[model samples]
Target: NAGVIQTPRHKVTGKGQEATLWCEPISGHSAVFWYRQTIVQGLEFLTYFRNQAPIDDSGMPKERFSAQMPNQSHSTLKIQSTQPQDSAVYLCASSLGAEVFFGKGTRLTVV
Candidate 1:
């Protein structure tokens, strides 16, 4: 149990560039979740998976945001043509029953 592994803990992208955040959930945990944190939103749920299957993505942007749970241990969040508004801390979490564990988060900055 590494909990969740998120790559590129800090990423700086130019306007219009893209950002891809990665996550490796805790082993044996049946659920993985993604969230975005900002001064205004605090923590907003982006998407989630159960048993490696996508469950809900209503909080994601319909055009440039996407999330995937490719296997039991990992998930990804891709944002295309990122704007300054997209800059935020992206967090990943995993849970089995009532306890949920979170990753350090990928901080994306679009300059």
Candidate 2:
């Protein structure tokens, strides 16, 4: 309910390593969105959750990308065996369709 909190605003991960990002959504807003932005891909929708339930995750990579919302307020995105292409700004947003707010995001750099 404190809006969205993203820790370690910047992160550097070695290739094949793991990088975990956290998110905290606004109160009363049941819809949370995850997106990855890069120079090549632009803004890509990773996944979304509504009412603490996964509504759509079709945009997520089938391999190492994973996301979850165990409660109404927070969610996490984990990348296992991250690759160089995974480097991007991971943003978390919350909305009710009419309005949406995004966090500053974690600038992930894979080296």
Candidate 3:
């Protein structure tokens, strides 16, 4: 498919464990965006990168959340010492111009 691909559609982790989510953007896209969705907060922007360079990550948690784009084809989001509060559907999107394409997302559940 032409859409972004997110791995492990569902994940279960123990409290204090680490969780890493993977995303592969569309082949020629220049920008990738990461977001978190939960019942309390509807779709919150976490971070984004343009040309594989991080632009902003203000919405990302300072302590445990981290994102990286090692190359143009893919990006990753890692959450260290995951907590119950960190449970949410993490979305990955890629854009070329005005329209953005999104993946099914990785659902993280911390217990």
Candidate 4:
């Protein structure tokens, strides 16, 4: 298996632009998670999907941040109205029971 695949290892967008990060989980995995990492925040859980269904998103911002698992193979994290504060490394992970695999992550930079 290719493990979890995240496209465009890095992204750069202007403030107010939108950035969408993509993730492809391992085959048959039932759970996926999104996290954001920053110098101050360390790693913060953003959202989670179980069986391609959204289960939690309490850590996500109230506006301009959203995550979707459209199918068993992939998920997407969208960030709109990008700001300098939004610049961080977005990580994707998938799990089967106890074992988990993670992608390289997408580093988003807003200018």
Candidate ranking under lDDT, highest first, comes to 3, 4, 1, 2
lDDT of 1 by residue, 1-111 (tens): 566889989999999998899999888999999999999989999998999888899999999999988778678899999999999999999999999899999999999
Tens-digit lDDT track of model 2 for 1-111:
566778769999999999999998878888999999999989999999999899999989989999999998789999999999899999999987779889889999999
lDDT of 1 at 46: 92
Model 4 RMSD in Å is 0.7
lDDT of 1 at 52: 88
Q: What pairs collide in candidate 3?
A: none
Taking every candidate in turn, the Cα RMSD to the unseen true structure, in Å, is 0.8, 1.3, 0.6, 0.7
Backbone clash pairs for candidate 4 read none
> Higher TM-score: candidate 1 or 2?
1
How does candidate 3 score on lDDT?
Answer: 0.97
- Clash numbers, per candidate: 0, 0, 0, 0
Best by lDDT: 3
Off by over 4 Å in 3: none
TM-score of 3: 0.98
Mind giving the per-residue lDDT tens digits that candidate 3 earns over 1-111? 668999989999999999999999999999999999999999999999999999999999999999999999899999999999999999999999999999999999999
TM-score of each: 0.96, 0.94, 0.98, 0.97
Candidate 1: list runs displaced more than 4 Å.
none
Where does candidate 1 have its weakest 10-residue lDDT segment? 1-10
* Residue 83 accuracy (lDDT) in model 1: 98
Best by TM-score: 3
Better of 1 and 3 by lDDT: 3
Q: Write the per-residue lDDT of candidate 4 for residues 15-61, one digit (tens) a residue.
A: 99999999999999999999999999999999999999899999999
